[model samples]
Target chain A: MSGVSEHVVIVGAGQGGLQAAMSLRTEGFTGRISLIGEEPGLPYQRPPLSKAYLKTGAADALTLRPAAFFEKHDITLVTGTRVDSIVRDTGHVLLGSKTLGYDHLILATGTRNLRPPIDGLEHALDLRTLEDAKRLRKELDRPRTCAVIGAGFIGLEFAAVARALGHKVTVAEAAQRPMARAVSSPIAARFAEMHLQMGTRLCFGQAVKEVDETGIHLPDGEKIDADLILLAAGVRPNVELAQAAGLPCDNGIVTDAQLQTADPAISALGDCAVFPDPRTGRLVRLESVQAATDHARTIAKRITHGTATPYAAVPWFWSDQSDLKLQIAGLAFPEDDCIECENGSVLRFDGDALTAAETINNPKVHMKARKILALQAPPGRDTLKRAGYDLTLI
Target chain B: MVKVTYIAHDGTETTLDGAEGDSVMATAISAGLDGIVGECGGSMMCATCHCYVDDAWSDRTGPRKDGEDDMLDCAADDVKDTSRLSCQIKLTAELDGLVVHLPSSQL
Candidate 1:
């Protein structure tokens, strides 16, 4: 089980960090695994924070693993601790007064919610972690008006819940359509309608000029009164630690397809890694659970078995907005053309090559799309059309 | 603690104490039992935690929700009549001795 040094220190004990530790053990890497997290409790999932956890308020369900799991897997989980710096030459990480050496280091620092430039931003709330969700849930308990600053998945998901809880909800997006960054315009249009149908107000092409305790002010000089304001604008990767260590940082920690940094002994994954997409050869950073766990598994395999195969897993993502679950397979670009399939799933193609597929409330189509994208040669428009848009045919 | 037994494809039965609030998938995952991937962390977005609820406890475990049923169709293994996404089934004190069979694979 021993390859090089015995200790592997992982920074950021979120989804990817925890998966790296768990996958290392499952891959038979019997080394000393130290998973350090800034959060004070067991590693938990973030997707539910904006989805079921908001409605159910079940904090335990968000936990990825319990304390017993760390003991059983021999994973040294250092909660409520942050790694200050990494010394590449000495292969050590400094955590406040303590310094721990590592045979290899993994950076799964993930990302933090980005707060847009607006006056009095302190009045806005966040829904990034369990703590944020708990606070937002408390705000939802009472009959209050909510103003979400973004129309991305998090913002829309929160808007849907806030509406369901009898709270007046208003989602304001700077773009013409909601979730324009992720989904196709057509799909975003459908979601916009769904929110409108649910008694939630949707404001497009509007930017927040300022935020006060009462509510948010639009650039058009319109004031919307809101008791709770949620800032779900977006997120930026936590790459300060890697940057301080002299590692290249783009939108995330730059890594090769093998997910290894310039320093071979160090690797990065999850929301914090900008790796080469084997399909499109584009440097992409994903924030989905699928990407995080898959990246962790790939890195674990390389560290344990020395199998340095380029990561080619087809990226998939899902967002639950009320009863409609939006699922996507593959990566879509802004210029990619979208085709509406018979099963109500939209397939995105970059010229001749299929880039991504988006589906709402259609898991079968989404699953088929994932399987198709995972292939060496994904089906193009002609093949997809000839197959009657049935993914099983190809 | 509610006792639950997860039978793997190889007929390896691993029984563990499950807390009342956590899902069966979470309990199995915490125990590090094989065959239950739980890729989506009980969101029903991924069918990696697909399992076959024993007929004896199927009624108590309740029926699969629409989302869970659709996800089971995507399970890597063969989807059976008793196939269920373990994540949707919350562990309860009443269902103390729940027994569910894990599929052959959960890629």
Candidate 2:
């Protein structure tokens, strides 16, 4: 395949899609690169849809790459066009009645907010795309109370911002703790306390039965009135295109360690792709800039340089709520034992082996934990203690 | 204002006055303290401002939650008992004269 005619067509022009195009050029691939996205404008990051972009209304900052970068890299970016289907037999993609052929197809469609079947959900707003953030920001201009559905990162982040802006915010979560699926219970409890201290009301362990014009109604028949309702419950992977193309689909588009789908010509990455974890060997789908960008780089190496190394980059994520910044170095399961260090760092261990480390506003230790985990033989507790708990010695 | 001391990896100590409600990361960054990048603007999304809180003052710092604990797993250096994300630590009067050691790298 080296030196042969290469034309790469990447679907979904978000962070991962843009990165794949950029990485291809960075790796010296001079072939034609076409990026197709359902959203309008250039590829942008979704992370800021709930943070600074929301507060400052800075949509420009969310751009993954400037429009000039695409021209400079000789990449064609097709925005505001939906890919109707992928014809595997013809090795082409159908975009709104037009068919474009490709040698390799990369799926970076990402995920969409899951809209559960709740009454009066039409009144509920979302915070996923840049436009959505802008709409929500405009809605926030008024002195209105908001009922935020879910206690996940996005929900809590929005709640914090709303409260800081002097708007009354109430968060309802079906789970007992905030971010229960993603973080440990202790962390969730601490976040709950922080939200409470910030004057954001929290309603946990109660499923929302409906969302009316007034507010949200819980399963227990309690109704909380509010002017706005923001749903940040969860996201569903964008796998319909792959599934329609007759490709294997799971919770996300199933990909191997190299991020290639079951079919050799197709590959997937970012929130839409589920690949094996380097540390745990479990299939996981991550919706972070790190994962999407790293996945793009890996795919680029494979396509341009012919490097077949599996995607083994360490996975990390962060979330901001109020003054607190939560940095995570690795993926951890609920079964992982949470050990509290003297300095307030939580070390998650699978038995004696450290699987992940969670740090709050502590970057130094977080970096150390990542390096330590990367080691062939990580220092044991006794060795770590002998060094006065200093990771640099290791 | 609370006084906080940041000890770098090279053993250089820089002292800074932290605002009452300012996070330790923000205080250190505002003080122009070396080794605190604070990427993601203290959102806890990036581990660029990782530090090692002194064991003696651990009680004042409280404990880390699971989300933070999970984030430390990707830090650039070795993990230790004193590991902490500086952004989560607020500079209150109770944390006066707090000290945090810097890591070698954040990459």
Candidate 3:
């Protein structure tokens, strides 16, 4: 067994950061946990911000735990505070006037909404944080025509909620199809059709050149009129702290399979960390609750339980758009082959290997895919074809 | 307020007060209770809040909803005849004295 840490300092107090603190205590760590977040109030989950919270306006439902949970769990939660810098040689993190020393430092800074270069971009609202969601939620009090900048998960989810609330919505995505980076072609096609049927205007391959009071101006000199605009284009990982601290940074902070940085004392997780994918051995940075929580569990175990296991949790994601619940199990690259099964489920294969499974309104198949993909030797395309591509049978 | 008793897999019982509109899983989560992860936060997407309603309350609770049983297949614990996603069960005056037995794990 390895040694236990005396004090674990987690920055960015979001879902992943809080999870590390919680998991450390759950793993029987007697160390001091300091969870510092840049945002005020309690840390909450982001997934519901686009779906349930948008529809019902239930803000309480998004909080991961109550305020008393920190005290009860013996966790020191610092809100509305930012870690200015990390003094690597001295194992200290600067928070304005104070210096906090930590035996182990966990970076869960997550990502910020990507604001592309467009004139009058401040007019577009964001749905990334609780504050952003609260602002957008109040704006949703009255029906207003909304033009979403991207057709990714957040963009479409927002479009669905806005349309369901009887608001006219238009989605402008530069990509030819929605969710091009994350899903299979068939899955993207189905969502495109669903948005069209919802009476929402979907403008694919349309690049916005400007965002003024009148709405967005397309590169083709066409314009879409809308009173409200949402910037759901995507996100840029918050790697400035890590990069400034002399940590390797690319698309995200580069970490090992164990999620530890080159400094050994520091580790990163969630949307900001690009680690090796256990299945494909490719560097990937996933922006999902699964990655955040799983990475937290892995890091916590490594620090408290003295387990040096690599992070290998199966990546699962869900998005509730209108009445369709799309769930994806495992990771699929952009160039992977997609085979839409007869039963409405789509399977993604990389060459002969089954890489991911996409299921719409089918939770059982999604769970089954997660189970099958966790195996040491996931089935090949021929084996899946023989099994009729049914995850249950396999 | 309704009185709900949660029995852990190890047979430890803890009773808590649940508001009429709150869910069984939400109450447990709010109280920071163990044995119920509630990962998806009560969306029918995840089945981490699986529980077995007492036999006395099973009939009143009724069978699993249309797609609930399918979601339960993802539960980390075994699914039984009395198995239900606690999120799907909302507390009411009639369920005041409800008791739920949590599985050993909700990983």
Highest lDDT scorer: 3
Candidate 3 interface RMSD (Å): 1.7
Q: DockQ for every model, please.
A: 0.53, 0.08, 0.61
| Error at A112, model 2, angstroms | 0.4
The lDDT of each candidate is 0.89, 0.83, 0.90
Error of 3 at A12 (Å): 1.5
For this target, which candidate reaches the highest DockQ against the unseen true structure?
3
Which docking category, incorrect, acceptable, medium or high, applies to candidate 3? Answer: medium
Query: Candidate 1's residue-wise lDDT over A78-107, tens digit each?
Result: 999989999999999999999999999999
Off by over 4 Å in 3: none
**Candidate 2 Cα errors over 4 Å, as ranges:** A1-5, A380-393, B1-107
Question: Which scores higher on TM-score, 1 or 2?
Answer: 1
Global fold similarity of model 2 (TM-score): 0.79
Candidate 3 lDDT by residue in tens digits, B19-88:
9888999999888888888877887767889999999999877778867977888788899999999998
lDDT tens digits, residue span B11-79, model 2:
999888888877888787555454775645555566667889998888789888545665577677877
Worst 10 residues of 2 chain B by lDDT: B37-46
Q: What is the alpha-carbon RMSD of candidate 3 to the true structure? A: 1.4
How large is the C-alpha RMSD of every model relative to the true structure?
A: 2.2, 9.3, 1.4
